[model samples]
Target: MIDALTVALGVTALLLAAWCGFAAYRDQPTKDWHFIGMAVVALLAVVQLVIGVVRLAGGDDPQQGVAIFVAYLIGSALAVPIAAFMSLTERTRWGSATVSAAAVVLAVLEVRLYDIWGGVGG
Candidate 1:
């Protein structure tokens, strides 16, 4: 995995979390701008997923094992979209909260991805 990309994703997710969290705090549902932000984060996650797959295809195995690593990649890629969908259904402050929670999850997944790839602490 690319360390810089991992860090970038993590930072972006945290930013999204804070943004949506504030919306929830203000008793608002996720708006168009929030979805756009989610889209950006999701795009980054998909890019990361593709990179991870390409590396694996090139015989670069993650230290933690391929199955788990791929699972994390897929989960991370889906997290935001799934939350966004759920947010749509709820259409309340909780919807924003859901997105906020998913962003936090994505951030956590970024750290775990780094570890799975044998980053310093792994």
Candidate 2:
């Protein structure tokens, strides 16, 4: 896996979490700008998923095993969009909280992805 891309995804997810968390704390729903941020994170995840698949096809194997790695890739790509959809249905501070939680989950997944691929270099 690409270390830089992994780090980028993780950092971006954390930023999104902080943004949405602040909004939730302010008792606000997810705004259009928040959705824009979600879109950015989702796009990055999709790109990462594609790159992971390509690497796998090229005979690069993840340390933890292929099935789990691909599962994580798919989950990472889906997490934000799923949370966003859930938030859209509620239209309250809880919605923002939901997104914030998803972002944190995505960040954790990113770290796990790095470990699964046997990331070594800093």
Point out the worst 10-residue segment of candidate 2 by lDDT.
113-122
lDDT of 2 by residue, 1-122 (tens): 37788899999999999999999999999999999999999999999999999999999889999999999999999999999999999899999999999999999999999999889742
TM-score of 2: 0.96
TM-score of each: 0.95, 0.96
Give the best candidate by lDDT.
Answer: 2
- What does candidate 1's lDDT look like per residue over 1-122, in tens digits? 37778889999999999999999999999999999999999999999999989988998879999999999999999999999999999899999999999999999999999989888521
